[model samples]
Target: MSDEVIPETTGLRYFDEWLIKKFLFSHIEKRIAEQSIKKYGASPIYLSERSQSISSLSEICKRRGILTGLGDLDFLQNCSLTQQHGARSGFVVLGQTFDKNLGEALQHHAQLIESGSIQFGSPDTEQQIAKFVEGIISPFKDESSRLKVCEDQALDFLSTAWDLCRSLIRQAPGYEPKN
Candidate 1:
C-alpha cells in the first residue's frame, strides 16, 4: 500500500527472488517464446543472435568495470511489481510485496511439489500461478480466492510491468541502472 515495508510478516511479503526468477519469470519467458515462435512465426535465430550479442557485450563491460549484471536483488529493488511506473524514466524498483495469505498458499504449494504431490508446470502448478497473478493484482476475498484488483491499481501494475519488461529487454549481461 504505502511505500514502507510491512513490519509484520503476516501483513505482506516479497516472493523469494530466486524462486520467482527460476520458477516464475524464466518459465513464463520460455513459454511465451515457444508459443510466439510456433503461432506467430517469431524467429528463433533473432533471439539466439540477440542473446549471444548481449552475452558478449556484457562480458566486455564486466571486464571494463562498466557493467555489473543484474541480480535477483536488483530486480526486486528496481522492478518491484508493487508500484506504478507513472512518468518515471526507470522501472519502479522496490520490493514486490503481496498478501501474506498468498505467501502461505505458495509455501504450501512448494511443499506439495517437494513431496511429489504436485508437479511443477502441471495443471496444478498452472492454476496456482494463475491464482497467484490474480492475487497480485487484487485483494484476497474469502481466503484469497477471488480476484479483486481495483481498476486503477490494475492499470498501474500493467503499465509498470510493461516498463519493467522493456527495461529487461534492454538489459545486457551486466546491467547498471542509469538512475
Candidate 2:
C-alpha cells in the first residue's frame, strides 16, 4: 500500500508505527529467535521482506548481537540450516500490516507456511502461524467469533478494517471450507 493516509481514518488505516515498534517488533522477533533456538539451535536467524525496513532492523539486531547478522537475501542460498548465519527473507511482513490487510496477508502467508516452502528451520513454525491466521480469519466464515483472538493478543483494530479483512480472507487461497 502507498504511504498515503487513509481517507476515512485520518491516518493510514494500518499505519501504526508506534505500536509496530513497541509491540510487534519484540513480539515477533522473539518468536523467530525462540523457534530458531529451541527447535534448531541457539543461532541467530532473522527473516523479513526484501526491503530497507527489514534490512535496517536486521542490522540493528546484528550490531546488538541479537542475530548472526543477515540483512541481505544471500542467506537463503546457503544449505546451512545446520549452520546458522544470515537471515531469510519473505515477500510479506505479516505482523506489521494494518488490521484491514492482515487477514488477507495471513491467508497468503499461511499457504507458504503450509506448503513447506517457507521453512524457517522450525518444524512447527508454519503450523503455529497457520493456527493464528485461522483464528483471525474464522470470523469471515463465522461472525460469532468476532475479534476475540485479536483482542486477546492486545491488537487494536478498526471496525472498517474488520470488514475489509474478512472480505480479503474470503478471497484468499483455500478460503473454501472442505466440509
Candidate 3:
C-alpha cells in the first residue's frame, strides 16, 4: 500500500473500461486491488495484461442475460464506459469522445437496440437509457417504465414540423416565380 496518489481525471485503461461494461460491477478501488493479484492478471483477464488488453476484449456485451452485436466490441465497451461510470469507477474524467450530447446519447441508445437483436435480448434498450442515465443524475423513477417516451418525442417534433409546413403553404406569396 504505497501512499501514492492517483488522480481522478485520468482516462481509464482498456481493460478497466471493458469489465465495467461487461460485468457492470467494477469499482475504482476494486481494479486497483485486483492489480495486485498474483498468478493471474484479472478474472476473465490476467493482471499482466494491464489496462489495454486487446486480446481480452469481448466480442459481445453480456448484460442481464442480454447480448448485443457481433463485431469487435472495443469502442462501444471501452469508450463510453468512463462517460457512464466516470469518477466513481476511477479518477476517469473522459473515456470516449463524441460531438454532442443528444447525438451521443442517441448513438448509445441505438447500439443498445442493435445489441438486443439476438434471442433473449432486450428489445427496448433505448427505452431504458433515459431512466438509466437519469438514475445517476436526478429524481426520475429508479427504473424505466415504458418505451413511448422516446417515440412520443419524435412524434411531437414531426407534428410541429407538419403544422409549420401547412402554415407556410397558405402564407407564402403564390405569384412568385424563380428565374
Best candidate according to TM-score:
3
Q: In candidate 1, where is summed lDDT lowest over 10 consecutive residues?
A: 107-116
RMSD of each: 20.2, 20.8, 16.8
Stretches of candidate 1 off by over 4 Å are: 1-66, 69-79, 82-179
> Cα lDDT of model 1 overall?
0.40
What TM-score quantifies how close candidate 1 is to the native fold? 0.18
Per-residue accuracy of model 2 over 89-169 as CA lDDT, tens digit each:
222123333333232322332321112133467888788678667766652333234335545444445766788998998
lDDT of 1 by residue, 16-104 (tens): 44323333333334445668899988934333322222232112142655533334333433443332222233322233336342333
**Considering TM-score, where higher is better, how would the candidates rank from best to worst?**
3, 1, 2
| Each model's total of backbone clashes | 4, 1, 8
lDDT for predicted candidate 3 compared with the true structure: 0.41
lDDT of 3 at 97: 38
Note the residue pairs that clash in candidate 3. Answer: 8-91, 15-51, 41-46, 41-47, 42-45, 42-46, 42-47, 68-115
Clashing pairs in 2: 14-98
Worst 10 residues of 2 by lDDT: 77-86
lDDT of 3 by residue, 1-179 (tens): 21123333237654453344432222223355466454365444332322223223322333564434322344544355334443223222223434343224224422211121222347766667755655556532321332355467679999999999887877788845447
